[model samples]
Target: MPALRTIPSKAGADPLPSPPREVEPRPATGHLAKAVRRNLTAHGFLIGAVLCFAVFSWYPMIREFLLAFQKTESGRSTWVGFDNFRTVANDPAFWQAWGNTVLYTAFALVLGFAVPFVTALVINEFRHAQGYLRLLVYLPVMLPPVASVLLFKYLYDPGYGLLNELFDLVGLPAQQWLQDPDISLLAVVIASTWMNMGGATLIYLAALQSIPGELYEAAELDGAGLLRKIWHVTVPQTRLVLSLMLLMQVIATMQVFVEPFLLTGGAGPEGSTTTVVYLIYQYAFSFNNYGAAAALGLMLLVLLAGFSAAYVKLSRTEDE
Candidate 1:
C-alpha cells in the first residue's frame, strides 16, 4: 500500500533549477539627507564670509561712489552731479599734487626698485651668516613704522644729528633733509626705500633661488663676468618677478601718504611733498569738502584699476 518513487533515466534532461531568492533594494533617502546636510554646512561657512565682505568691503565702496556725486552740508546730503569733480579739477593743488605724486613714484622706481634687487643679489652670494644678514635688513620693517620715522626724524635734524656729524667728518656742508623743498621729497623717498625694501629683497631672493644652477654654471663656463651673468642669466630668469614688483611699486608709490605725512607734516616746504592722497585728506579732513574728497578718490581708483587691467592684458599677451 505504500507510494512508489521513480528516478530519472541517465539520458533524461536535467531537473529544473530552484527559483532565485528576492532581495530588497536599499532606500536612497538616507544618502540624500547626508548630502543635503553636507551642503548646508559648507554653505553656512560661505554665507558668513560673504556677509562680512558685503558689509565691510563692498558697502564702503558703494557708499564712496555715491558720496562722490553728493554734497554734504549742515548734516544733510544733496545731489550735486559733477559739481564735486569740477570743484576738484579747479583747485590749484590738484595739478601740483599729481606732479609731486609722479615725481615721488619716479624717485621710488630709481631707488626702491633697484636697491632691493641689489640687496638680494648681494645676500645670495654670501655663504655664511645669511640668516643674520636677512634679519638685520628686515629689522627696520619689524619695528613700528611710527617709531622708525621718529628715529629718522632725530637723525635728520640739522643740528646735533648723526647724519650731519658724519657729513662734518667728511668735510661736507651740513644739508637739510626735510626742511629744504628741493630735497625733501628725495629724503622721504630714501626713508620709504629703507623701510620697505626688506620685503622686496626677500621676494627677489626667493625668485633667484628658484632659478636652475646649471644655467649659472654654463654662463661661468662661457667666461661671463658677474655683471654679464646678471644681464644674461639673472635678469631674464627673474623678469616676471621684476615686472610684477615694478607694477606694485608704481601703484604703491603713487599712493604715498604715511612717509610724507609724518616726516614732512603732510605738505613739506612749498607743498613739494603734497601727494594725491594727501590732497584727498586735506579735502575731507582739513577743508571738510567730503564731495571733493570722494571725487578725487574715485578718480584715483579708476586710474589704478585701468592701469592694472592694461598691465595684466599686456603681460598675458607677452606670455602667449
Candidate 2:
C-alpha cells in the first residue's frame, strides 16, 4: 500500500482522434452545362419579345423608308426619288406647320419646363404634406390626354367657360382663349402643361431629394436666400437631370398633337395650332397622300435627329 501511494497517476486519458472529411472536386463539364442551360432558358423566355419587336417595330421602321420613296398608282408601286419630299416641302401648310411647331415648343419650354421645376422645388422643400401636394400636382396627368384636352376645351369656352367666369369675377375682361389666334396656341400649351406637368414634376422632385442637404446648409451659412440657394445649390446639383428633362420636354412639345388636335380640330383659328405631326396626319388620313405623309415623317425624323445631335454637342460643350 505504501509503494502504490508513491506512484504518479494521470488525471484523464486522451480522446481518440476523428477521421478527416473527404471533399469531391466539381467536374468542369458541370459548370459549362449549367451555363448552357441558363442561357437556353433566357433565350427561350426572350423569344416572344424578340418576335414581337421584329414584327411590330423593326419591320415597320424599314417599311417607312421604303414608303417614303415609293408611289403607288393603278395598283402598282414605283420609285419617286425625292418627289414626295419636294411635295411636302412645297406645300404651304408644311412651313406653317413648322412655324407653329417651333412656336409651341418655345411656349412649352416656358410653361411646361419652368412650371414643373418650380412646382417640384416647392413640393420638395415642404416639411409636411409633400405626398398630398405632389399627388394634387400630378392628378391631371392621371386623366386621359383626350379627356384632359376636351375638358380644357370646355373650360376655355368664351361665352360660358369657367375661366371666363373667373375672369369676370376678378374684374378682368373675358377673353377669347382658344378662339383668338393670338392666344390659341398659348392656351393649348397651358392645357398641355396642366395635363403633362405631373410626370416632369415628379421627376424633378426625385432629383431634388437626391441633392445633399449639406449643400443647402452651406449655402445658408453664406447668406443665400431661397432664390440664391436654389440657383447655387439646387439647380447646380440637378443640372444633369434638368438638361435631360429639357431635351425630353422639347421632343414632347415638338410632337404635341392630341391637345391641339382635340382642342382646336387639329388646327387652331387660321392654322395657328397645326403642328408637324398634325400635318402628317392630314397628309395621311385627311388627304390620303401616303407618300407625302411618309416624306413628312422622314423630314420630321431628320429634323429631330439634327436637333438631338446639336443639343448633345452643345450640352457637351457647355459641360466641358
Candidate 3:
C-alpha cells in the first residue's frame, strides 16, 4: 500500500512496456543494390544523350533563328528584328522561286511516286530475270550525283542532245530542253526522276514482298484479274510504305538543289528553274546577305513543317 501510494495511476503510467523502436531501413544490397545501380547508369546515359542533342541540334537551330533577326555590318551583328523578313517578302524573286519549287515538287512527286511503285509491282510479279531487272533499275541510284547530273546535262543539251537528235530523226520539232526557260524545269525533273526512282523502286519492292502471298492467291482463286488484284490486294497491302515514300519524296523535292544547280547552272535561263533552296543559296553565298538568307531559311523551315504536319495527319487518317 505504501509503495502503491507513490506509484502513478494506471491511466497516467505507461500503460504497457515502451513500444519497441522501429528498425531503421538498412541500405539496399545484392539484387536491390544492383537494380539501383543499373537505373542510375541508364539515367546517366539518357542525360548525356539529351545534352548532346541540345548542344549539337537544338543550339544550332536557336542560333539560326537568332541570326535571322540580326544584321551584320563589317563583322558586327546588330539586332534588326523583322527587317530581313520584310525584305524577303517584298522581293519578287521570292514568289517566283517559291512557284518554281512548288511546280518541281508536284512534277517530282507524280513522276517519282508512280514510276517507282509501278516498276516495283512489275518486278515483284515477274517469274524470271527479276534480279537483272532489279539491278538495272537500281543502277542509276549508285552513280555519283555529279556524274549523273552531268550525264543528264549532256542528254538535255539543246543542239546535239540525244533527245533533240531523236526528235530530228522522228521529224518532230526539236524543242529546247535546258535552253528554254518554260520547259527546262520539266526536263530537269525527268532526269532527277530517273536517278531518284531507283531507290524508291527498291523500297517499294521490299514492301511488296512483305505482303502475304495468301492474299494474292485468294484473290486469284476468286477470279480477280491482275488489275483487280493489285487494286484490292497490293495497293492496300503497301499503302503505308507508299504513304511514307510520298512524304519522303515531298521533303526531298522541296530541298532540291544539286540537280538544278548542276543541270541548269544555278537557276537556269531567266531564273525559271530557281527554287526556294537555290534562292537561299543566292542570298547567303552569292550576294552575302546573311540576314536575308536566314529569313529565307526560316521560311523554308515553316513550309517544310507545314508539309510534314499535313503528311502526318494524312498518315494518321489512313491508319484510322
Candidate 4:
C-alpha cells in the first residue's frame, strides 16, 4: 500500500506531534518469572515431600494391595484372586488373634485410656511440684521403647520380681504376671500403659489446664463432691479431647505388637496376647506367607478405616 502524507499544521500552531508508535508487546513472563523465583524453595520442598511419600508410604501401600491378591514363590508372582484372603480366614490363629486383639483393646480402653486422664486430673490438683510430676510421668516416653519393655520384663518376672515383692509387702499373693494366659495379656496391657501413657497424660494435662476454674467452683457451690464435679463439669468440658484420644487409643491398642512381642513372645501363653499386628508379623516373618500377611493387613486396615469413618460421622451428627 502507498503511504499517505499528513496535512501540515496551521501557521503559529505547534507542529502536529508524530503519531505514537504502536510498539509490539513483549512476552508476559515478568510476573510468572517473579512468582517462580519467589516460590522456588517452597516448590522444591513440596516436591521432596511428595517424592518421599510416593516412595516410602504410598508405594508400600500399593504393593501391599497387589500382594494381597497375588502369590509369590521363588521370585515369581501370580495372581490368585481371593485365595490369600481365604487362606488367612481359614488359619486357626486368625480368630484367636482377632479375639485377643479385641480383648487387648478393651483392656487398654479401660486402663490405658482412663489412667492418663486420671493422672492428669491428679496432677492438675497438685498445687506444687507440677512440673516435676509432669517430668516424672513423661520420663517413660523419653526412654527407649525397647529398654522400657525390657525393664517391664524384669518387673514381671514370676520369681523375685519387684512387682511380686511389692505384692508380698502388701500381704497379697505374688500372682504370676506373665506366666498365666489369663493374666498374661493383662500384664502386657499394664506394661503398655505404663510405657505409652506419658504422652497422653501430657495432652490431657494441657486440656485440663485449659478448663475454666469457675466451672468447678460453680459445681462445688451446688454441693457437688469431687467425683460429682469431675463427672458434671470436667467430663463435659473435655469431651472433644476425650473422644479424639479415645479413638487414637483404640487404633493404637488394636495394633499392639511390641509389648506382647517383647514381653510374651508375641503369643503369650496359648495366644492370649496375640494381637492382629503380631499375627501379621508372624505370617510375614515367622510363617513366610507374605500373601496371607498382606491379606490380614488389608483386613485390619479396612476395619480401622471403617471404624474411623463411622466414628467421625457419628461425631459430626452429634455436633449437628
Best by TM-score: 4
TM-score of 1: 0.88
TM-score of each: 0.88, 0.87, 0.83, 0.89
Stretches > 4 Å off in candidate 3: 1-56
lDDT computed for candidate 2: 0.90
The TM-score, computed over Cα atoms with residue i paired to residue i, of candidate 2 is: 0.87
lDDT of 2 by residue, 141-172 (tens): 89888778778878998999999999999999
Output candidate 4 Cα RMSD: 7.4
Q: Against the unseen true structure, what C-alpha lDDT does each candidate score?
A: 0.94, 0.90, 0.90, 0.93
Give the per-residue lDDT of model 3 (tens digit) for 1-320: 35545766788866666889999886667768778787997889999999999999999778779889999889999999999999999999999999999999999988988999999988998999999999999999999999998888788777788888899999998888888999999998999999889989999999999999999999999999999999999999888888888889988999999889998887799998999899989988888888999888898988889989988988788678
Candidate 2, residue 187: Cα displacement in angstroms equals 0.7
What is the C-alpha local distance difference test score of candidate 3?
0.90
lDDT of 1 by residue, 1-320 (tens): 99998887867968788899899876799888888797997889999999999999999889889999999999899999999999999999999999999999999999999999999999999989989989988888898889989988988999988889999999999989899999999999999999998899999999998999999999999999999999999999999999999999989999999999999999999999999999999999999999999999999999999989999999999999
Give one digit per residue, the lDDT tens place, for model 4 in 69-184. 99999989999999999999999999999999999899999999999999999999999999999999999999998999889888988897899999999899987888898999
Residue 29 deviation, candidate 2, in Å? Answer: 9.1
Spell out the clash pairs found in candidate 3. none
Off by over 4 Å in 1: 1-45
State the RMSD for candidate 3. 9.1
Worst 10 residues of 2 by lDDT: 1-10
C-alpha positional error of residue 128 in candidate 2 after TM-score superposition, expressed in Å: 1.6
